[model samples]
Target: MERLDGARGPRSPDRRGLPARGLRRGHPPAHRRERPGDHARDRGLGIALSPGFLSAFVFPSFRRLWIGAFLSSIGTWTQDVALSWLIHTRIGDPFYLGLRTFASELPLVTFMLVGGAQADRVDRRRILLVSQVFQMSMAGALGVLYGLERLGIGAILVIAFLTGLAQSQSAPTYQATLTSLVPHDHIPNAVALNSLQFNLSRAIGPVIAGLLLARVGTGACFAANVLSFVAVIVAIARIELPPVAALGRESLGQSLKAGIRHVVESPILSALTLLGATASLLAFPLITFLPVLAGDVLHTGAPGYSLLLTSLGVGAIAGAVTTAHRGSVPGRGKLMLLAFMACGAATVGAVLSGRQWLAMALLAAAGFSLTTAFSTLNSLVQEHAPNELRGRVLSIFGLAFRGGMPVGSLVAGGLVNAFGAPAVLAAFASALFLIAAAIRLRNARLRAL
Candidate 1:
C-alpha cells in the first residue's frame, strides 16, 4: 500500500519467509486509515471510503451541488437543441444561427468580469440563487411566447442574451464554490466530476429534445428547462457553505484590473489562459461546423449529425471520468499537454476521413483528448487561485474558455465558404497541433509542472 506522501508501507514476510513487497505488515492500508469527518454527516450519508472517479462525492455538499447542477444542465442542453433547430428551420439561414449564438455568448465575455468581482464581495450562494431565478424566468417566458405563437427571432435573441447574462453571474461563483465544497487535495476529482456531468448531459439532452420537439414542439423543451432550475435552487438553499472572509470593497474596475494583472504576471496563468483560448478558437470550432461536415461531406443529414455529437459527448464523459479516477496524480501538466496535442491530431484525422465510421471514431478521440486537456487545466487553475481572487481568476479563465468559440465560428464559416469545410477545418486542426508542440518544446517548466 502507498501512503499519501508517496511512500510504500512496510512489507511483511511471505509464506516462503521472504519479505512480500505487496503485503503491509504493521497497519491497515492507507485508505482504511481515518481522517477528519469520516463519519456520516449529511442526510445520513458518509464520506466515500475508497479512492476513484467518484471520490468527490465523499463530500455531501459537493454531491448535492453536483446532482442538482447535472439535472439542470440536462434541461439546458435540451433547450439549446430545440432552440437551434427552431431557428434553423424558421430562418433557413446560417447567418441567423451564427448571430443567435454570438448574441448569447457576448454578455458572458463582456460582463462576467463584473460578476466575478461581485462574487468576491458578496455571498456566492445568493448570487447563484438569484441567477437561477433569472434564468428560470427567462425560460418560462420563452415557453409562453412560443406557445402563444408570438415567438420571433428577435425575441429569441433577446431572451438568449438575457439568459447568457445570468450565466455570466453564476458561472464564476459556481467555479469558486468548488473550492469550498471539497478539500484542496480533492480539487482535481471535483473539477473532473463537474466536467463529467456537463458532458453526460450533452449526450443525453439532445435525444430528449428530439422526442419533445417531434411530439410536443419547442415549448415543451423550454418548459422543461424552466422546471429544472427548481432542483438547483433547492439544493443551493439546503447545503451549508463555510463563511467567507470579508474582502474590503473595491471598485469593479479595480477588481477587474487586479484580476487581469495577476493573470498577466503569472507565467503559469498566462500560458494556461493563452493555450485554452487558442484551443477554443481553433479546435472547438469543429463542433460549430459539424453540421456542415454531416450534410455536405458525409451526406448523412440530421441523423448522422446527431450520431457524431453523441460520439463526442460520450468520449468527453470518458475523459472526465479518467481524470477523476486519476485524482491528483503527478505529471498532470505533461499529461495535459499530450492530450492537447492528441486532440488536434485526432481532429485533423477526422476532417480528412472519407468514411463516416472513421470520421466518427476520430471525432470521439478528439473529444476525449480535448476534455482531458481542459479538465486538467481547470484543476491546475483552481489549485493556484487564492481564495480572495478565486472568482475573478476563474471568470477570466471562463472567458478564455467560452469567448473564443463564437469568433472562431464566424471566421471558420467564412473560410469554409471559400475553401470548403474539410480543408479549412484540417488546416485549423494542424495549427492547433503545431502550436501545442511549439509551446511544449519551448517551456520545460510547463512540462515539469
Candidate 2:
C-alpha cells in the first residue's frame, strides 16, 4: 500500500520462510506509520471523517448564530432576485446595470480595512447586531418606497449601496466569530458548514422569491427581507461569545502595517488572492447580467430567470456538500485549476445552448465549479492565518472576492454593448480559465496549498 508521505512501505515476505528487508515479522506485515504532520495534513484536507466533526456545528452558540444567519441569508437572496428583476424591467441599460454592481460592491473596497480593525477592537456580536440593524433599516426603506409607488432606479441604487456598506462592516466580525465558536481542530468543518448554510439559503431563496413574485409583488419581497433580520438579531442576543484576548498595545498605523506585511509575506496566500481576483473578475458578473440573458437571449421571462438562479444555487450547494463529505482539503491548486476550466467551458456552453434546459444545466455546472474554487480558497486562507490578524486578512480576502464583481460588471457591460452578451461571456470565460490554468501551473505555492 502507498504510505501517507508519498513513500512506499516495506514489502511483506514471500510464502516461504524468508524474511523481507525492512519488513516487520508478522503474517500481515505492518506498514510504515504515518508521520504526525501527515495525519494533520490529512485532517485538514477532510480525509479523516471522525465523530468529532459534528462538534463543529452542534455547539450551542454557533448553532443559534448559524440558524439566524441562514434565515437572514434566505431573505437576502430573495431581495436580490427581486431587485435584479425590478432593475431589468425599469431600465435595461448596461451602464446602469454596471452601476448597480458598483453600488453593491464599492463599499468593500473602500471600508473593509476599517471594518477589519473594528472587528479586532470591538465586540464582534455587537458589531454584527448593529450592522444587521442598518441592513434591516435599508430594506424597510426600500419596502416603503415600493409601497408608495415612489421607487426609482436611483432609489434602488442608493439603497443597495447603503446596505452593501453595512455588509462590508458586518462581514469581518462574522468571520472572526467562527474561531471563537468552535475548537481549532474542527475549524475546517465549521467553515464548510457555514458555507453550506449560505448555499442552502441560496438554493431555496430564489424559488421562494419566484413564488412570492408570482403571487404577490416585488414589495412583498423587500418587506420579507426587512422582517427576516429580526431572527438573526434575536439569535445574536441569545448567545454569549468568549471574552476577547487583550491585544498588544500598538498604534493603528503599526497594526495596519503588520497586517499588510503578513499578507505580503505569505506567498501561498498572495497567489491565491490574485488568482481568485482574476476568476471573480471574469465569472462573477454573470449574476448581474442573468436577467438580460434570460429575457433577450433565451426568450424567457421572470420564471426563467428564477430557474437560472436556482440552478446556480443548487450547484453551489452541491459543491459545499462535496467539500464537507471529503472531510479534508484536497489538492487545492489542482482543484482550482479544474474548477476554472469547468467554469469556462460551462459558460461557453451555456451561451451556445439554444435549448432552455440545456442552458440551465450548463449554468449549474458553472456554478458548481465557481463555488468550489471560491470555498477552497477561503478555507486555505483561514487555515493558514494567525489569530491576531485573522480578521484583517480575511477582510482583505473578502475585498478581493467581492470587489472584482464591480470591475467585471464594467467590463461585461462594455463588451455586451460593443459585441453582444454571448460573445462577451464567451470571451471573458475563455480568457479567465486559460489564465487561471497557466497561473496554477506556474505557481508551486498555489498548487501545494
Candidate 3:
C-alpha cells in the first residue's frame, strides 16, 4: 500500500499497480507530482524560502493540542508564580525556594530515559492522560489546602515534587506526539506552532497571574490552575491521532543505550544538546531568583516580581513568533550559538541595571534568546532522530533542558546567599556565553550540519 498526502485530495492507483490507502480511483498520489512553480528551483540569493508555514495552523489535530495546551499553560504559570511566592512568604528562605525548584526538576534528570522509553512503548495519549490526571490531582490538593488556609511550605514543596515527577513523565510523550499529529512534511511547522503556543501562554499567563495575585489571594491562583487542566484533558480525549506502533522492541536499558549512542554518533545533535545543557545550567537558574530580585535589589515586592516574570514571558512569545514567521530556517547551529550569546548579553545587562524597568527589559531579552535557542534545539533533535528512537531522544532533550534548572537554582541560590544576586548573575552569564562560543568554534561539523 502506498501512503498519499491527504492535503491534495484523493490518490488513484498508477501504472505501478500500488493500492491507494484512502483515495478514489484514477488519481495520482497528491504528494507525488508537484504543481507548476510548487518546487523552488531557482531564486535570488537574497530571497527567503517560504515553506507553507500557514499549513500548520490549518491542521486540526495540532490546532486542538496547541489551543488546549495554551490555556492549560496559563494556569500552570499562575500556579507556579503563586507557589513560588507562597513558599517565600511562608518559609522566608531563598534556599528552600531553590530546593523546591530542585525537587520539581531533579526527577527529569533521573527518570527521563525511562519516561522516553515508555512513550516509545505505549500510547502517548494515554501516557499524557495519566500524567495530566496526576498533575491535576496535585493541583487540586494544593487548591484545597490554600482554600482552607492549611497550606504550609512543607506541603507545597511535597506537592511541587509530585507535580515535577508528573511533568517529567509527560514531557517526552508530549514532544513525541507532535510527529504523529501531522504529515512528515509538516513536522517542522508543527514543532514551531507548538513552541508558539507555549511562548504565547508564557507571555499572557504571568500577566494574568499578576492581576489575580493583586486582586484575589494566591490561593485563587492555585484554584485557577486546577481548572486549566480540564482543557487539556478534554482536548486529548477528543483528538484522533494516527496510530503509533511499537518499534525497536528492546529493554529500557538497551533503548536508553541506543539513544545515547545515537547522540554520541551524531555530532550535530550532540553539540546542540551540550550547548543547550550548558546554557540551561548557567542562565536558566536566574528565574528562581526573580522573587529575590524583586524584593531586595528592586524593592518592588510581589507585584514587581510578577512584572518581571511577565516580561520574560513576553520576550519568549516574541521569540516564538519570530521562529514561526521564519519557518525553520536552516543553520540552527549558528542560530543556537547566537542565541546563547544574546542570552549571556541579556543576563549581563540585567545584572548591571539598577532600575526595575531596565532589569525587566534585559530579562525579557534573555527570555527571548533562551526560548529561541531551546525551541530550535528541540525541533532539530526531533528532525534528526529516527522515528522509533524519537521519544527517547526527546526525553533526553527534555531532561537536558529542564533538569539543569534544579542544579542551576541550587548554585544560584548559594551564590546569591554568599555574594549577591548581581554577582551570581554576572558569573553565570559570562561563563555560559564563553562556553557556548568555545563549543561552536571547536566543532566545525556542528556549524556545517
lDDT of each: 0.73, 0.70, 0.70
Cα TM-score per model: 0.87, 0.86, 0.86
Cα-based RMSD of candidate 3: 8.4
Please identify model 3 stretches exceeding 4 Å from their true place. Answer: 1-53
Q: How close is candidate 3 to the true structure, as a TM-score?
A: 0.86
Those runs of model 2 whose alpha carbons end farther than 4 Å from true positions after fitting are 1-55
Task: Give the C-alpha miss distance for residue 257 in model 1, angstroms.
Answer: 2.8
Candidate 1: tens digits of C-alpha lDDT, residues 1-449: 00000000000001111111232345332222324454244345645445677776766566667777777777777787777767756775555665666777788888878877877777777777777888889989999999899999999989878877877777777777766667778888888888888778777877788778778878999988888777777767655455555766667789889898998899888888887778778876787677677767888755566677778878888998898889887898889888989999999899889778999899889888988998898888888888778988988887887787667777787778778889988998888889888878888867877
Give the TM-score ranking, best first: 1, 3, 2
Task: Estimate, for each residue in 5-46, the C-alpha lDDT of model 3 and write its tens digit.
Answer: 100000011111221223233554323332323333322223
Q: After superposition, how far is residue 265 of candidate 3 from its true place, in Å?
A: 2.4
Off by over 4 Å in 1: 1-42, 45-49
lDDT of 1: 0.73
